[model samples]
Target: MTSPAIPFVASSSYPVRAGNRVRPLIDGEPAFRRICQAIEMARESVQVTVTFMWAAFEMPDGRGSTLDVLDRAAARGVDVRLVFWRPDAETERHRRNAFWGSAAHVGLLEARRSAVKIRWDRAHPGFCQHQKSWLIDAGADGETAFVGGINLNPHSMVAPGHHGEGHNHDVYVELAGPSTVDVHHNFVQRWNEASERLAPDGRWGAGSETDLPFPTRIPAPCGGATVQVQRTIHAGRYCDGTAAPGGHAFDVARGERSVFDQYRAAIDAARRSIYIENQYLDVPDIVDCLHRALERGVDVVLLMPAEPDVTLPVSPERRAVLDSRARLGAFANFMLAGLAGLGADRRRKPVYVHDKLMLIDDAWATVGSCNLHRYSLFGNGEMNVSFAEPDTVRALRCELLHEHLGRDTAGLDDRAALELFRRIAKENRTKRDAEDPAWQGLAFELDAATHVG
Candidate 1:
């Protein structure tokens, strides 16, 4: 079956840049602002892929609203195309309250009437288009792509302990280099595939076919920066009523393998140091990887939420995994204790890694939705971006390691180490509780654990 032609710009006509400082937007406000700035500066087309989107008029800085801006941009002859996951109408109530409602659908409907294109990613039922990114036209100069875990929703931008609190930690990268093209290409592929499936005879929704128009070519930014685009997709399940002739589509195991392969390749390439920040640190393979790296004399530091979302009662199997994680923590403590013994005066520290990020060799870094757990790496639809920019990567690595070591200098006394660890645990726990009152018990447990010994 011949697929629809994917829109593309001639590579030769546009100039590309390399060796640029890829800024990491740490908070949601910065991320949203950067996105708006890129959109405002867009001269031709805009493409956005997200897991969820909420329609709201009230946003920080009164930056006019998400829906209003998108509509206006489309009206100005800017080719705007958005691909998003379509949640079941039944779940709309819960989703609407959680922040990301059917805004993508609503926004797309409005845009479609205005001659803008919209596509729903019906790749796999129950699985989502979990990538959060946007590509804006930089004219013939180049394009800017924002890739990260931040969903385009209001709840994500609020502070950690606000009235509508959520565990909204994320990192986004703004790319104005060669990597942006690759990111743009990926979006085109997914959009085209979605458009095909959403056709009248296609298998997306039981309705009349709709065609979304998009640009053929986008300009490339001229500079020196290399960025690599990586993604995870669900291939086994047939969401479009199409069977995998090779039987490869029936094997859910292959998706798991792909995820593991990507992660292991990245981990094996690390030289010097690996810093990660994640929501969960319970995955055995990931833990083992760090342990092996530490044995090889690589500096590994992780920042994680003090308490995980296992606050609601869990199954015996899940409980077992959590217990095993605690045991692993004990093992890490034992290793650190041995290291402390050798130094005599230096303090020993237990690793409580979180925050789902990793910076290696001060040149390569990765940030995304994949956690250090089997469910995230192997079971669910996840997205991550990995790139190398010496200055930015090195700066982030230094900042994280500085906090881990308790100072800018190398010498860290035992007292300081203990205090630092305690503070981290305490702050994370407090934040978790403030987000969810049910997490109060977890906070207490964290405090007790830090106080013990």
Candidate 2:
């Protein structure tokens, strides 16, 4: 049967878009693998905006590093542009390396001498330019884009069906059709502004001499799904604190919170269940809405990391992870569960859940960089692609559950599937405490609000 139309709404926050082909790329291996492939297939341009990237990190299959891949693409005449977060003084020490285009970083780019150019943008000092996105040949018939929270860090390089330290579970949506125009719009806005901040210190070389043009017309439709390109952007980041001229309704000067608006509205409209997999659950508004949904008999299931990523022995950063965990533990309505995997010593090891995802009633879904945390929902520059396609949402839910629980929902309805997860998670928690010999898989429910971070 054909699924009902999603009734996607556009307002001051989210603008409605249609005819987008959205595919959920689960785990780092598939997400990065597909992203690299799309970059390779680009005929005109490749634009990437990410929070942080490691200089030494390499793609799976020994492809050197992300820069190496971009260099290869640039050598073939593709205009490769990189926009990386220029971490504030306080945050700089925590990033994998100094921001891109630094003295040392520029030397690497100069050595390649490819068509690649880069710029570093400073966020709200307290927040970050946290969106992870890629746009390929926007405004063209075959244009495509990707959006999600997967960073270019080593912890996010793990393959699907594999487990270890630095193993992070994440998702990125591969997008085609009219929605790619919106992605293109966003890139042009950031790139033009970031270019202004670039110094004449020979960092950008000749590649930064010209600015990419704003998408004049929306791309032709590519598929059947309805989509809304949403974001959380702090005020004054774009458009000189004014509403964008045309084809976009967002005014970052007013502090657009489309992602938060969408989540609350979707929860309010949910009739059966809401499934979420996020790194943090510290937002009070979201927690309150979930409590109300639970009162209306809505089933809520959330997946988070069993142990804080910051708490890892070799992890250089701890304050952010530890701080976020403390706030998440305050949610009264959330029965948070930490995922676990088996250690080499035959003991249960904590599996980190880093994906930001949400599904409602098997009819609506979202996957992207915005976490259910204050910084992400309010202050950070973030982006997410939401769809009202029932088939895609249900399939994504099943895929996530199968990966984590080692079993499928087996044709259960949304509510029943959520209940099954509750039952299995409770059983897993009991087994974990008893030190049972059987494989514990991933889900382990918490008995109290106390956090494991």
Q: Which lDDT tens digits does candidate 1 get at residues 262-302?
A: 45655665555555666665555665666566556555444
In model 1, state the lDDT of residue 330: 38
Q: Report the lDDT of model 1 for residue 273.
A: 53
Against the true structure, whose lDDT is highest?
Answer: 2
Worst 10-residue lDDT window, candidate 2: 311-320
Model 1 bad stretches (over 4 Å): 1-21, 88-94, 97-115, 138-140, 158-167, 195-225, 236-259, 269-272, 311-317, 331-355, 398-453
- Candidate 1, residue 146: Cα displacement in angstroms equals 0.4
Expressed as tens digits, the lDDT of each residue in 49-91 for candidate 2 is: 9787888778867777898888898889888887878777756
After the best TM-score superposition of candidate 1, give how far the Cα of residue 41 lies from its true spot, in angstroms.
1.1
What TM-score does each of the candidates earn?
0.67, 0.89
TM-score, cand. 2 vs. native: 0.89
The segments of candidate 2 whose C-alpha lies over 4 angstroms from its true place after superposition are 1-14, 201-203, 240-249, 309-335
C-alpha lDDT of candidate 1 relative to the true structure: 0.50
